[model samples]
Structures are given as C-alpha cells and as structure tokens.
Target: MLPYLRRLIRDEDALLQYSAQIRGLTAGDIYIGSYFSVAANWLPQIIQAFQQAYPAVHVHIEECANKVMYDGLEEGRFDCCITTWRPFSGDWIPLCEDEMVMWLPENHPLARAEVYPLKQLCHESFIEPLPQQDTDVVRILKEEHISYETRYTAIDNYTTYRMVEAGLGVSMNNRLMTAQWQGRVAILPMDPPHTITIGIAIPSRDGASPAVKKFIHYVQQGISQILAPR
Candidate 1:
C-alpha cells in the first residue's frame, strides 16, 4: 500500500509542475531584469519593440546589479533577463561587447595622456562601483598586480560618474554609462584594454509560456537585426 501511495504522489507532483510551466508560457504579464548601466541605453529600445508586437502583454522592468538579476532568474521570478556574458545552461544570445574606459577629472595630470595604463592609475584614488557585481576592474587589477585606494564606492554608475566629474576621484566605466554625461571628464583606454560581454538569458524557450515564447523570440530577432553590421 505504501509503494502504491508513493507512485500516486509522484504522478500528482509531476502533473502540478507541468501545469506551472504551461501557465508561464501563456501568461500575458512579463517581468525583465537588466543591469543599471545598460538599463538606460538598451532596455528602452527593446521594450518599445516588444510591446509594439505584443500589444496585449504587460511588461515590467527592474534594473539592478547583474548578480541581483541573475538571482531573480534562478528563483524563476523573472521570465527573462539580460546578464553578463557567460556560457549559460539555458537559451542565450551574445548581444554585444562593451569596451571599458577610464574616467578622470579634466585637469588631472594624466587626463591628456594618450592612454591611461592600468598600472599608472593604480596610485590614484579609485571610485569603485558595484563591488559585488562581476567586473573587469578587479579582475584586470589583480591580474596586473595593481592596487589603489578606494576614495568612494558607488552602488550605481551615475554616482560614480558624478564623483569623477567633481574631481573627487577617478573611476572606470563603459560606453553606456559615459553616454549623455554633460560634465567635463577625460576618457581614456586601458593598456591592452578590457571589455564587458553582454548577453540575453531566457529560462527555456520550450518550457516557457506561449506569451513568453513569443516575446523572447521577438526580442532575439529584433536585437540581432539592430546589431547587425551596416
């Protein structure tokens, strides 16, 4: 009798799980997550395109450090999200590469230097951002054996940029964060350079709801078209 009960319980659990996956697909509401930097530059365009195609669907956007977004993905709270580049176990797309740039006060001694070598800036005060998020700053700094003082640590890119603009300290950032900055600052490339890989992560297209599947497909296609070479 106990053996028979075990089989019945297993079957019931499987049935419930399958139903949940089905609901995830056809659900008309979608929530997306992205990093703070890219949220401003990339998400608006993607949202506009997705909503235009799926007029009846409701979409929500949450911007945070990349790790926070990935945590949401693991807990199945978000349908899909943009994550730092990695060989994901689920459906993935290599969106684009972003080059890291050094930001310094306009009148700093190294401001006019043709290039800001990583080792050279190690002596200057560093305005670190998103210390918890996976970033190339700590990676390359450690690799090159460079060390510096953290004059300020920022949770968001805007605060980091503002500090650099005020001549409080220097920091590193990518194109997305630098764009639309109306302040005076010197931007330079690092020696040998570094890049951030951006990609889209979907839980699983086949296992997702119909609405999710449709929107994911549309996003992938539209991103590819826009990013294609001119």
Candidate 2:
C-alpha cells in the first residue's frame, strides 16, 4: 500500500491535477452541511464523484437535522447544504425531486393498501423525528388537517426507521431516498401524492471558492443527469 501510494504521488498527471485544484480554491477547505433525509441517498455518490475529480480539496461534512443544517450555512460554517426543503432565499442547485410516501411495518394491515389517504393515518401511532423542527412528517400531517398522537420521537432518522421496523408506528419517507432499499418497512404511495425538492443551498456562486464552484458543477453535470426524470 505504501509503495502504491508513493507511485501515485510520483505520477505527473496526479501531481498536476492536485496542483491545479489548489491554485485558486480558497481556504482549500470546503465545508458541506446536509439534512440527513436527502443525504442518505445522494450525498455518497456526490462525494465519491467530486473526490475523484478534485482529490486535493478537503471536504468536511456536517450531517445534521434539517433546520440546523440550513442555519449552519447562514452562520458561514458550511459552504453549502443538501436539504429537502428550499427556503425563499438561497442559491439552490436542484439535485432531484422525490415523492413522499408512507412506510409501514412489514405485514401491517395498511401495507396491503395500494395507497393511503393522509387522513386515514390519524388513528395510528406516529413517530415524530427529533429536533422535530427539521423533519417533514409532522408538518405534512398538520397541513392536511390530519391529527395524530406521537408514540415516539427519534433524533436519528434511521432510528426512527428502526422504530417503524419494530411495528411501533407508521411514518412518511421519500421515494428517492429509500429507492434502492426497503429495509423492513412497506412503502405505499400517499392518496393525494406529494413531492419534495432535494438540492444544495450554496452561499452564492459569486462569493464561493473555486472548489465549491467545481463541486456544484460536478453535481449538476453528474448527479442531476442521473436523477433526471425517465
């Protein structure tokens, strides 16, 4: 491994690429914040692709609750953030839009239904995500005039998923975020159907570092194309 590392460092193309990435990138440190809901699916691919193109740039990720992540960007801690909801003001690069769906424990009675009306879920136990301000489950229900009682609250989104897997409650999750994996939950489309935008909120293109600009371009060129409607 050491020998291979030395060989890679000695390669002319690698050296040139590394040098080029550092030449104009400010701080050489790119901090990215992310709301976990969207990050779980898309962030890994974005990071992997970006790192391959700019190996010299150091990317620091702060994965947190939604609202907090947006705050972090405003506080100048993150050059950009990946979130489900876009605010009224921000320089956004839309990655993809996802359908909001219902998740039920395996074998739960409602799992057999082709679709679930938001109102029909009112009587079942609901698991609200913690920092509760960040997650959308509660907000969606409230907006639809559906009343529910919370049986549990989870700080980690996956922990909430686990609680659902345990048959404790039902909840809402995104289609793209959970696309390739179902885990132990049964996914059903919502009756009225809904969608959420998932994307990056950057400080601004004019004010961003070269590295940030390159990353945003990379995501737009690569990730967005993959996520394009078929």
Best by TM-score: 2
Give the distance in Å from residue 82's predicted Cα in candidate 1 to where it truly belongs.
1.0
Cα displacement (Å) at residue 98, model 1: 1.1
Report lDDT per candidate: 0.73, 0.72
- Per-residue lDDT for 124-217 in model 1, tens only? 9899988867665666677778878877899878888888989999998776677767788899888868888777787676666556666667
Mind giving the per-residue lDDT tens digits that candidate 2 earns over 1-230? 65455333334333454466567532255777876654666667877988876777787777786778776665655677877664735687777777889888987888888998888777888877664564666667767888788878878767878889999998787776466666889889998888877787876766566677777787677776676789
Task: Specify the poorest-scoring 10-residue window by lDDT in model 2.
Answer: 6-15
- TM-score of each candidate structure, all chains considered together: 0.80, 0.82
Indicate the worst ten consecutive residues by lDDT in candidate 1. 6-15
